[model samples]
Target: METDLVIVGGGPAGLSAAITATSYGADVILIEESFSLGGQLRQQTQLHANLPSKFFAERGTSLVKRLTSQLETPNLKILRNHTMIGAYKNGHIGVTNGKTTFEIEAKKNIIASGAAENAWIFPGWTLPGVMTAGAAQILLNREFVYPGKQVMMIGSNSFALEVVKQLYECGISVQAIVEASETILSRDQALLSMCKKNNIPFFLNSTIESVSGSGHVEKMTIRTSEGMMEELEVDLICTANGFSPILEAFQIMSCDLTHSEVLGGWLPTYSVNFQTSNPSVYLAGNAAGITSLGSILLTGEIAALSALESLQFISERDSNRKKAALWEELYQIETFFNKDTMLARLELVKHYHSERGLPLPDFVDPLKGEMLFG
Candidate 1:
């Protein structure tokens, strides 16, 4: 089949781009790997904010549904269970289900594959009972199951703390939240204070020495600051060190990629419009870098505008106008969030700024986003 735009991920970026592109009078198809969509937000407990409280209790799933439903335009098609594997020079894409590989030709593409959890190696990282923070969240949100009755939560960032809340809501017990850093990152200061108030000790400058269990995780041994050891008997250990974007596809496509530890690893260089060095292709959302739903949606719209311009569906001047307007909106939202302490743990915590009075680049590649945005 052929399309004007092929969005290769159904997460926030791809979905947002699809909606915007279709509204702009382009035929768009969004292919997602998993059966369900919503990307990372699907696993989150609540919508967080770095700005003034707008919609506090808005569930992540609810936002996904509203966006999905709104984007169900006749020109927009969503294909779930489609895993895109290759992008050809002519802009054709190869996608696979278990038994079939389908080729779809498109004038332009958006890579929004999102990100995967980062698994830090430890003595017991490979244990069966060990799971990423996102994985633990999936069980709780989608399957309506908790990781364990009593669990040892590892990592001290937003993802880890969010898991703690999820566990509590599910009526599971948290033995302790272990942090490698001296300070923990959480959205709610009240929650952090409560943890401390309840004497749920937060380990500072500690690491898991080993996890011991025969078949499943039974206990975890950790090294503390004073050269002392602590052990907790828990059925599962949820580790949330953060995430690494799924940028390997860009490498395979020979797109110019740079390593930005700030961007959270290897990332492709793309215009503000999400265009890679290969003008016809684009990337949006977490696939570019870890960002919230709002940012992802904005990136998707900008990317679509650029892609249409590349294909001559939209005039450069028109596309530029749209791009500028969207960017200004994004800037407003981002700037407002910069002062919010809740998102200190998020990767795009600060606005993109340059020192030495040098102006920032017009477009940032994925690799450079980490350094520039980090």
Candidate 2:
């Protein structure tokens, strides 16, 4: 199949891009590897904590519904259960829907492929009762199945905190929260207060030495900060160590990449417009970097606008205007919820400028609300 634009991922970013592009009369194809759209939003059961009042307290599923509702434009085609396998330099991409493989040629492509959960490996991580926080979330919110009767979280990120609250709501016991850091990593004070109110024990400066059971996880040994060993009985171990961007497709497409620890590892080097080193390719959402949900949605629309401008489907003047507004909102979200990501992006742009021998004065740091190169 061929189209004007091909967006890989049906999550918030991809969905937003498709909706924006299609509304402007672009022939858009949205491919999702799952049977349904919404991606991680389907399993999210908490309100957005750091967004402005307009978006704050809104559920992820509600955002998914809002974006998907505008997807009925005639210029848009949805391909569910399709996986992108290969991306060629000539604007052709290989895709498969489990049984048959096909290729789709497009004038422009956007990868909002999102992220993968980071693994926290310990001596019994491979056990049956051990899983990622995302897995437990899907089980509880989507499948309506309980991951375990008594769960112990292995990380203290916001994702893990939210999952613990969900478990508490479902009447499941959260044995404890173990963190290898000196302090709790999650910045959401509300969730932290909730955990405190419920009296969930927190083991700071601690590490899971090992977990043991006959065939599944039944007990875990923790190395506490005081150089002491402690044991806890728990049926499940959930790791919420955060996520890394999925950059396999970007690499296959030959987009230039750079590493930033703050951005969650290697990501495609993108411009202010979200265009990658490869002119026809763009990135959005977690595929660009780890960020809040509001920023992810803005990146999607900005990427679509950039692609549309490149295709001449939208005038440069109009595109710039729309993107300026989107960038403002993006910076607001990042400043309030993802300051680390903002700094990472500044560093990424500096590297991009240096590699291309572009003068620094031509670039501005919108995230910092100041001229970084002047």
lDDT of 2 at 85: 94
Q: In model 2, which regions exceed 4 Å deviation?
A: 49-56, 357-374
Candidate lDDT scores, in order, read 0.72, 0.87
lDDT of 1 at 152: 79
Question: Quick one: best TM-score, which candidate?
Answer: 2
Give the top-scoring candidate (lDDT): 2
- Candidate 1 Cα misplacement greater than 4 A, ranges: 50-57, 89-91, 187-190, 335-374
In model 2, the Cα lDDT at residue 254 comes to: 90
Q: In model 1, which range of ten residues has the least summed lDDT?
A: 341-350
| TM-score, every prediction | 0.86, 0.95
lDDT of 2 by residue, 1-374 (tens): 98999999999889988988998899999999999999999989788655533455678877778778889888889999999999655658889998999889898999999999999899989998999999999999999998999999999988999999998899999999999999999988899999999999999999999999989999999999998999999999999988999988898899998888888888899877788998889999998889888888888998999999999999988988777777767766786786778778767766777787875432243544552531
* Per-candidate clashes, comma-separated: 5, 0
Q: Candidate 1 at residue 115, lDDT? A: 84
In model 1, pairs of residues that clash are 262-370, 263-370, 267-367, 268-366, 269-365
